[model samples]
Target: MNLFSDIRTLVIDNLNAMVAEGALPDGLGFDNVTVEPPRDPLHGDMATNAAMVLAKPSGKKPRDIAEALADKLAQDPRVSTAEVAGPGFLNLRLDTSVWQTLPSAILGAGASYGQSDMGAGKQVNVEYVSANPTGPLHVGHTRGAVFGDALASLLDYAGYDVTREYYINDGGAQVDVLARSVYLRYLEAHGQAVAFEDGTYPGDYLIPVGEALMAEVGDAYVDQPESVWLAEVRSFATDAMMQLIREDLALLGVEMDVFFSEKSLYGTGLIEAAIDSLRDKNLIYRGVLEPPKGKKPEDWEPREQTLFKSTAHGDDVDRPIMKSDGSWTYFAPDIAYHYDKVQRGYDLLIDVFGADHGGYVKRMKAAVSALSDGKTPLDIKLTQLVKLYKNGEPFKMSKRAGTFVTLRDVVDQVGPDVTRFVMLTRKNDAPLDFDFDKVLEQSKDNPVFYVQYANARVNSVLRKAREAGIDVDDATLASVDLSGMTHDTELAVARKLAEWPRLIQIAARTNEPHRVAFYLYELASDLHTLWNRGNDVPELRFLQEGNTAASQAKIALARAVSVVISSGLGILGVTPVEEMR
Candidate 1:
């Protein structure tokens, strides 16, 4: 199904044959041999670097090896022709049947066409959207949430046993601040004036929590001291905040398999266990006497602290696990969390963090590395900021969130499909610009609409066919004679369809869901180009008057393109609209 990978195998087979014939050495390493789509479509269906990579090792010229490899490759029924081009690269043109067969494969596979086993069932723990449970998820958290959810889905499709997780920050001092804030709301609920102090949350979100607290306890804690009410209110307030975070995530169709509480690590001896595991490995130490590189001499001070030997695993410096006050640092529980994931017997770990947490990546990786003894690999992806715009001007704030734009604010206005697709229009590490006007615009410049339009156009064709009493279902068209689709423009679209499985693996392996967005756009472009061509060339149209046979084949190709688009969009959590309305 993967044409590029198949062709690479073909190239390797021919190289082995050449070695048997004594034209090349038997032991030449073929690891670097690669077959891929050439930069330009005009070059060939596929291109291989077999000659160049093996020339020096084989003690033979690249052009000489390429010519021999070309002849053997041409013997395969799938490869129609092979030619040696500049620098002895082999370009191959696959037979028309290869392109024609793709539509049938797509129809038969349906939505599972691009699903791959690239991860090989590796247990991958993807911890993401671990935002503080202080408030509802905002636009900043939305990007990470969407990116993480789509990643878990993508890895699942790629055959990874993925666990979508959220780490709650309830054990921190912030929760105490939240409790005090909600206590103010409780006092106000009792008809007493309350002023939010400097460290208390002032958002209206906590107002309801205050009222709920009053309803639950009546007047019991009306004038209670901080010790009598802080713990109870903090627990209640944290749970309520977590509920709000869950609702915000649900708005974007995100579901987590686990909601890990950082507070659990404190009383469970898990933090001590994780730190002790590192201590046993000689990674824990009471050290750290150097000042920061650029710190002023007056400001710099030497302080001995409990540290993890993160430098042993490539961190810039050792990381502190505990302060002089003996309380665990923020990074302490994080280590325990990942250690718990490692002990869960996962083969891989992936963390989806905000760009602000880029500094934590190295130490986290170091922790996972030491915990798993390098048996498990950890991949950390940082999602950058998403700048919002409206009518070409920067959108500054959200009324509901009281600070940043809430996730619901974006989803409510644009729906989940647009929000998901537009969020993945750029690389995760790169800044994304969410233009409210452009995403909804029904123009080629808007990728989301363009892709949906392609699917809608396919439906339009099927609607017309069904209305004309023609069988337009996939089963009927899949078995139709596709000889009429031999035109250059028609076959070009099929070529793009052939790349779906290969593209999926690449995107999934790189953990880059944005690649699916790019592929969908390109596939949509090819589809639209073919559709536009029908206006000028009457015979290229999908509707063939009085010729159902030819119409079925052509329509099959069009439908197959839409199927791939829908499948790709599904991977990115996008929905294909039936119509532009």
Candidate 2:
């Protein structure tokens, strides 16, 4: 149950009663009213702005409305006290019994404790890590992959019908270069010496692809012209690279629902169909774009080209759809891809792009707006770069990838759990430093370790209680009497537990999975604080010397913390450790 939502409903219901009694006006919008945790725990359990937001609309003084609302709220069995704070704010302290019920509720619900119906099963398509199928995923792609995968899981937890997608960028020049690179490797397999020029890929990962091609066809395309082999080899090379990419993603436990090929948009008139949808609205036209901002007149030339009126929908300038040679621009394929998604009847579209694609954000949004006639909403999140460090120095590049560190390079060094958790400790748009020395340090400074340690310690408590002949199972502990848990420190962890559902709603609404990571860290801190206090205060411990009932009551609290921690880690795509090793 969402405690904050329940309390806010209480405040609204009381306000409605005040109106029925003629103490306030008939018309008032209570949508702006909110009940949230107080800034300082000493002040109260929850604070509401109900009185402050209603005073002006109801034609009453702020303090007068607040005082009246306080009396109505104080009468509830759940609220122990309600006081009018400065300028009409209302602070509320909940009854200890209210906090006591949370552990039982959490145990009853298990991993589904914080699952929300906020999205109401809206169809959401999340496309991420759509890297060019020329090589294995790198560190930058790793961040985007982790972020997008976690986000899709978060939306699923919030009741959205989410489809994870990957767009294969094989309709570009890069794939042709990949085919040439593989051909060189194929020649090398055939006992011919070759040189990898400036444009072709030089990574050793392609050596296997080349050898495979040699094994498949046995030198049929050995000295053939570009005309006979370029197209077939391009298709073959793209498939191989995509296989490598799939393996890389599988290593991180990411699976996609769709893999759309850009080439499908080229031959089947899909791009034309998407462009025609815009033309029907008079958005597609032939226009000469002004010279780019910092260009000299001698270096710039004006050309009339097929363009989309992207600025009409909030882009900085209009964007071209076709080049002068009648070739589709890079944005054209992206527009068609999103158009395909919109046509599939998705209610929302989310694109996770690399930070280098920041400039395409507005134009892509504008295209979706124009194509969907402002019906479908597109949100693009750009994941920034990740700097790798080991032993306080920058990490070296992967020889397999040749130019940068591959996703396997990071995962192999510190397992996928640490890799995924450490990737999300920072915001998506902010730069992150993934240090090999720090993330696995087994200290409080490592968030992943600290959070996992909390869960491990909770299991230890259960083990000790079980050895003491006390029933510490979820079924028995959930029915234990928790009314004896009145200490402020003991109740603090329950209060934090009550915030899980609210936190999930906020993070899902904002499309940010990092918030879940942050909340888990804070929840872990609260659990750890209570566990540490048990060392000196025997009554605060999870195990009681002689009283089995008291031990079960305290163990219930620790078990509840692990339930939420496991759920939160599930959303972040990390496996929770049961025992510290």
Candidate 3:
């Protein structure tokens, strides 16, 4: 159970009683009332703004209302003291029993302790790692892949129906370029000299695709014209590149529920249908955009074009949907893609994009808004760059990727768990520095190691207890009497455990999975603090010698920490280490 929510309910019940007794006004809005941990722990265990928020509304002094509210709250068995702080704030100190019993509650819930129904089962489409199918995924796409996959898992934990999706950028001229590059490789496989001129991929990764093409049709397309091989090779090369990308993602433990092809939108009526839907709403028009700011009039010429009135939906300006050559502009297919998402009946849409695509955020949001008529909410999260370092110096690029570090390069060096956790150590919008030497260090400064160490320590405690002939299973520990757990340090760790459910709701509402990583670190810190304190105070140790009763109660708390850590790491797509090697 959520202790914070339980206490908030207690606060509201007392307020309603005060209103019934005519001590407060009949109708004071309780929506603004909130109960949270006090800013300074020295003040109290929890603080509420019930008195302060209702004072002006009820036309009564805050202190007068606080005093009456305090009397009502103090009568409850859970609250030990309810005192009025500065101006009308009410600070509460819960009974020691409240904190002592939290371990039992945590054990009872197990890994589902922090799972929330905040989303109420709404369908959410999360599109991420939609990198061009031109080559294997690079380091930048790795961050987006981790962030998006973790977000989908987080939303799932928060009770949202999540769909992990990847949009393939295979319809553009880039595929044609890939085909030509593979043709050069094919020529090389046929023992012919070839040069990769401008606008063609020169990476050795495509050499295999060229060799495979020669093996598939031996000497058939040798010295053939462009028309004879362009379409066939484009399709073949796109599949190969996609396969490489999928393998790279698999290396990092990411799997997508759908792989949407942008090519499907072409040679079909889907694009026209999406544009016509907007046309029916008077959002499509033939107009000429004004010259961009800072451009001299003599340096530009106006050209009338088919445009979408994106300004009506929140874009900075109207955007062209068709070029002067009468072909669809880049933004048209994007609109069609989003329109298809809206028609799929999803309640929410979330796109994880690279930081370079920040400018596309507003236009994409505008498109979804116009398509869904502002019904379906869309949130675009932009993942920033990751700077790699080795021994405090900048790391070199991957030879396989040619110009950038591949996802497999990072995963192979540090393994998937370290790579995923380090990627999420920073906020998505903030730049992250991944230091190879520092992340693997087994010290408190290394959050991943510290957190994993805490879990490992819990496993050690369980093993010791079991060897000592003390029953430490969840059912037995949950039922153990915890009245002796009155040490200040012991109670502090329990207090942190009580915050898990509340933190889950906050992180889910804000769509920030990084907060989960941060909370796990804090929880791990509290656990380590208590574990170290036991050395000075022998009686505070989890395995109490010759006392099976006391040992089970103490070990219960330690095991509860592992349960929460496992749940948190699971959401981050990192397997919890039972024993850190």
Who wins the TM-score comparison? 2
Q: How high is the lDDT of residue 28 in model 3?
A: 84
Compare the candidates by lDDT and give the number of the best one. Answer: 2
Report, for every candidate in turn, its global Cα lDDT versus the true structure: 0.89, 0.94, 0.93
Q: What would the TM-score be for candidate 1 when compared with the true structure?
A: 0.98
Query: What's the TM-score of every candidate structure?
Result: 0.98, 0.98, 0.97
lDDT of 2: 0.94
Report the C-alpha displacement of residue 567, candidate 1, in angstroms.
0.9
- lDDT by residue (tens digit), candidate 2, 1-581: 88999999999999999999999999888999999998988889999998888888888999999999999999999999999888888999999999999999999888888898999999999999999999999999999999999999999999999999999998899999999999999999999999999999999999999999999889999999999899999988999999999999999999999999998998888999999999999999999999999999999988899999999999999999898899999988888999999999999999999999999999999999999999999999999999999999999999988999999999999999999999999999999999999999999999999999999999988888778778887888779899999988889999999999999999998999999999999999999999899899989988888888888899999999999999999998999988998
Clashes of 3: 0
Runs off by more than 4 Å, candidate 2: none
lDDT, residue 76, model 1: 97
Model 2: which residue pairs collide?
Answer: none
